[model samples]
Target chain A: MRHGKYRFLLGALTLPLALYGLLVLWPYLQAFYLAFTDWTGVTSEVNLIGIDNFTRMWSDPLFLAALRHNGLMLLAVPLAVIVVALGLAAGTRGTRVYRVVYFFPQLLSVAIIAVLWQFVYTPNSGLLNGLLTGLGLDSWRHSWLAEPDLALWCVIAVLIWSAIGFYVVLFAAAMESVPADIMEAAAIDGAGELTVFRRITLPLIWDSVQVAWIYLGILALDGFALVQIMTVGPGGPDNSTEVMGLTLYRTAFTYSKFGYASAMGVAIFFLSLTLAVLMLKFTRREKVELA
Target chain B: MKTIRHTVLTLWALVFTVPLLWAFMSSVKTDAEIFDSPWQPPATPHFENWSRAWEQASIGRYLGNTVIVVGGSLTLTMLLGALVAYCLARYEFPGNRTIYYTLVAGMLFPVFLALVPLFFVVKQLGMLNTYHGLILVYTAYALPFTVFFLHGFFRALPGAVAEAAFIDGASHAGVFWRVMLPMARPGMVSIGIFNFLGLWNQYLLPKALNTDPDDYVITQGLAALATSRGASSDWSGLFAGLVIAILPVLIAYVFFQRQIRAGLTAGAVR
Candidate 1:
């Protein structure tokens, strides 16, 4: 009877198990295999030119530019988004209207956000430039998305602005997770609000902050949709906004160099994995202060 | 202090809403009015733009396609994710840890990295450009995160319920579908909302697989409208398309703000 029951359980679980393995594992494994071969994605003729893809990646100026763009985004986008969100969260607590308004952008798709910002960054008749010209600062107005020197920075600004709502909501959620009694106690002990936040609140929600940092780091490297829509994959004027994600995408689909793109994807895969592991390890090392 | 807090949040919220409000208002404005007064509200609101956007851009077709893809993917993913979560949370089988860890590992792997291989795989299956194909890919991609989120909720449930069901001469499947699932509605709802939004907002997967214009989802269609064919001169029509694209998402957000927020937080936390 026990044997029959075990057999039934195995039979029931088999379909789901196979589906998961086939769906997730199979594609990932195939990706690894294709990364090493010169598969142009047209034919089954796979040439195993060992390490050629990787060697080519080292010399690819496009890949390097992509790395640089992502690096700059890493430095700028999350920092800007989070800092503004932190300020918003800190300033607005226990207010219904505040919650509703802060989450407005979370509803927008990347295409919509890109289009909205495209209007804002329009050169002559743009709301931004119109304001600049209206303020008698015509000299200060410049082509925002077209200027190569400032283009990536412009894209970064759009990304930061569009992503602010999510972080504001996240930070607000994390801030709420901090115990009220601890906050009140800090206040009673003659600590200012800023002091209370810096000392008491920050430590308790360190895990949540780490979560945000990790998520943003992944987003930083994997950015594509907005960059593609805003800057057009080649990163206009001179590959200025060519981040790694866009580069890999164009390499695969646009250029049809499937092997080269897969190789780039693998590099990105390891890059994200390394950062995630390092962040998790770093967080794990910190002592959890249980009050 | 309350007044100060309210004022600051309201101001920031206004800043957040301005672009969306602008897009929405511009969608309804006449072309001449859009150029004449970019910031001002239309003297008489033109709701016809919504219909125009729908008809001109063939947004109806795109919306229908999006619904098919998102709905198909959401149902399949939630069922599969909940099953896997149940297995991981309740049963003790050999290789259970291996299965759980492997699923979690897929979460860290970015979708971009798998696009090429996934495309070829879909092509091999002769499913590209079909709703079934796209739905399958989405379900597979979304499964890991859904499983991860649902696992937490399932684990949090008391074991006695399942134990009682098992002792009462119920089959394992009966216990899962009848006893466990009904009780896991909140978790399932949260996962369902997350999958809906993610699949709805998706651009890259559909773009990569479906080159046929008929199969284009709203995101891909809106992008193609704005950049490809519509890049000729005036952007009024393209902006109209953009507004059409985001309207459904906005409506859903307005209606289900709590569920959406909780869904997002649950995915991230797990």
Candidate 2:
């Protein structure tokens, strides 16, 4: 019986394991080796110059600028998403209607979201500028995606707009799990809504909050598709909205510098891994168990 | 306090819905009206925009391609993922923990890291630019989450049914297929919807692997349309394309709202 069970397990595992190993794990392993070479992705001949690509990336202005933009998004998007999601989740606990509406954006693809926002941010006839001018705040209107200073921030705004709803739904589920009696007791004992939320609700849902933070951080790191679809030159007005993923794409596919691009990919992999681990460590706490 | 909450929630809802509503409205307007009075209702609704996008712009082809790839990938991912997850969940073996953890770790790997090499890998296998290539890649990428979700679900099911089937002289494969799989139906539904929406909306993998215009998925096709015709005088067609691309997803959300929400949050909250 044991021998038959082992044979069955091996048979079931064979195909998926083989596919996963071939497609996913093999490429991941190759990323490290490719990072050291000068392969142009067009030829079989390869020469590995160790750490040269890494050294070049350190002084590369475009890479640094892209890294800076990702850093800014990392700080801004997750913080804004968490705060707004928490507020919405707290304020609309019992309402099913609003939850559905809020989560609507989470359903659309990044490509669709980007295209829709391009119209919203169009300089002359955009809905945003139109609304602003209609409200007599004509001074606030500018080319949102065209300006170097505002372009990355505009992308971050769209990121927040699309992401908040998912976290709102996530936090709402976590909040619903908090025992109602505890919140009611706090209210009766002269605790206000804000106080009860800060004291009771926030602590209870800290686990979900931690996970959401990591998830959003990972998302912030990969603003490639949105930046690809929305921006001019796909990372421009002079690369202001350039991201590592986009930079890597153009470097390998357009410039044929696969080796240099592999270095960038390695950097992104390490950066994301480090960020996720650090977030988990920083946010680690004793699990709050309700009596 | 109650009124304030209602007002805030209502305002947020509007912010989420108005853009989609505006896009749908704009899709049915002429180019001049869309630019002239962007917010106003169309004077005469232009239903030709849909036909134009569907026929002239080739969104219809892209939609069909997306459906095929998503359907094929979703079916394979669920089947392979369920089998592997069931073994890990139910059976004990020497390398069981190792295999399970290895699959879970695949979730941490960002696809961007593997893009360049994966392009070569797929090309080497002669899978690039083919539907099977994209389907296999999508299935491979989706395995981690599918296995993770279903493992928990299979473990939660009562083992009595499978044991009873075995006692009735059913082979192990028969017990798994007949008894165990049906018990995991709800889990399958949740993960199925999740994978369908995800695979349907995938852009980067297809963009990297499948470069042929005829092979373009919905996202790549829409992106091509926007870039090629965005600056041209086809504003209404572009809007119509956006509507067509988003409509199926919106409809799915409406129908499977509960499953979608539960499945999405399951990974984070659990």
Candidate 3:
């Protein structure tokens, strides 16, 4: 019976496992190996350069700038998204209508979202500037995606806008799971709404919050599609909006530096792994089991 | 206080809706109208814009391509994922846990890392720019989530029926095909819808693997339309393309909002 069971399992697993190993795992392992080589992506000859790509990355201005942009996004986007989502989620407890409305942005592709925002951020005829000028606040209407200092922030703002909705829905679901009676009891015990949220609600949904953080951090790290589509030169206006994903893409595809790009990929992999681990560790809290 | 919360919620909801509504409105407006009054009702709605975008800009081809790729990928992913998930969930064999963990860990592999090598791999297999290449990659990528979701679902089901089926002289394959799979339909539907939305909206994989203009997916096609030089003159058409691209997903979300929400939050909360 044991042998028969193993045979059945092997029969079921063989095809899927083969496909996965070849297409997914094999490529991943190849990428890790290629990171140390001097493969230009044009020719078949890939010479092992032994961390030269990694060493060069330390002094590469473009790479460093891209890393810095991703760093900023990693911190800013998640923080802004979580705070607003938490507020909206907490405030709209009993309602279902707002949840649907807020989640609308999450439905569209990042490409579509970027295109929509392109029109919104257009200089003269864009909705944002038009609204600002119509309100007699022309001074506040700088070119949203043009100024280098403000371009990445513009990208981050779009990131936050598109993302906050999903987390609002996510956190709302988590918040809703916390019994209303507990909140009411806290309210009766002279706790303000903020205090009740801080003292009771936040702790209970810490797991969800941790997951949201990791997800958002991964997203922030990969602001590639948005930056590729929305920004002036595709992570331009002086490369202020450059991100690691975009950098890796340009390195591999544009410059044809496969080895160097693979090194960037390795860096991103480690960075993402570290961030995920650190978030899981730091967000650890006493398990609040509700009866 | 309650009113304040409602107001804030309403305002934020507007923030999400108005941009999309604005894009939709702009899709029907003439270029002059879009530029002249950015927020006004179009004096004469150019309904032909959609037709023009469909016919002139090659968005129709892109849409067709996307449907094929997404459809093929979803079917394969669901089928293969169900097989793997059922095996891992139902049978306890040597290396079962190892296989399951490895599959789950594939979810965290940053796709961009494998871009260059995967490109070469596809090229070597003579599959670049083909539907098969994109479909296969998407299936492989979606396996982790599909297997993960379905594994949990299969575990939750009562195994007595499968046991009875086996005892009744049904082959293991017969029990799996006729009983276990039918019982896991809800899980399949949820994950299927999720995968449909995801694969449809996928930008990066298509961008990297399939660069042929003729074979571009909807996202790629829409992106090309937006960024191309002639975009300035075809603003209404561009808006129309955006609408056409987004409509299916939006409709799906509206109809299957509950399932979509459940699928999205499934991994997060638990």
How would you encode candidate 2's per-residue C-alpha lDDT over A259-289 as one tens digit per residue?
Answer: 9999999999999999999999999988888
Give interface RMSD, every candidate, in order: 2.2, 1.2, 1.5
Could you give the CAPRI-style class of model 1? medium
Q: Write one digit per residue (lDDT tens) for candidate 3, span B134-242.
A: 9999999899989998999999999889888877888777878999999999888878877887898899999999999999999999887787745446888899999
Whole-model lDDT for model 1 versus the true structure? Answer: 0.79
Clashing pairs in 3: none
At residue A35, candidate 1 shows an lDDT of 91
Better of 1 and 3 by lDDT: 3
Models ranked on TM-score? 2, 3, 1
TM-score quality measure for candidate 2:
0.98
lDDT of 1 at A40: 88
Worst 10 residues of 1 chain B by lDDT: B227-236
Candidate 2 residue pairs in clash (backbone atoms < 3 Å): none
Residue-level lDDT tens digits of model 1 in B74-186: 88888878887887887787887888888888887777778898888888889999999888888888888888888888888888888887778777777789988888999
Docking class of 2: medium
lDDT per residue (tens digit) for residues B1-270 in model 2? 788879888999989998899999999999988889778889989989999999988999999998889889998999999999999999987999999999999998889889999999999999999999999999999999999999999999998888788778887788789999999998898888788878887989998999999999999999877766635659999999999999888887889898899877776654
List the lowest-lDDT window of 10 residues for candidate 2 chain A. Answer: A1-10
| lDDT for each residue of candidate 1 in A32-148, tens digit (9 for 90 to 100) | 888999988778678999899999988999899889889888878767776787888777677645766677676667766776777777775467776677688989988988889
Winning model by DockQ: 2
Query: lDDT per prediction?
Result: 0.79, 0.91, 0.89
What does DockQ come to for candidate 3?
0.72
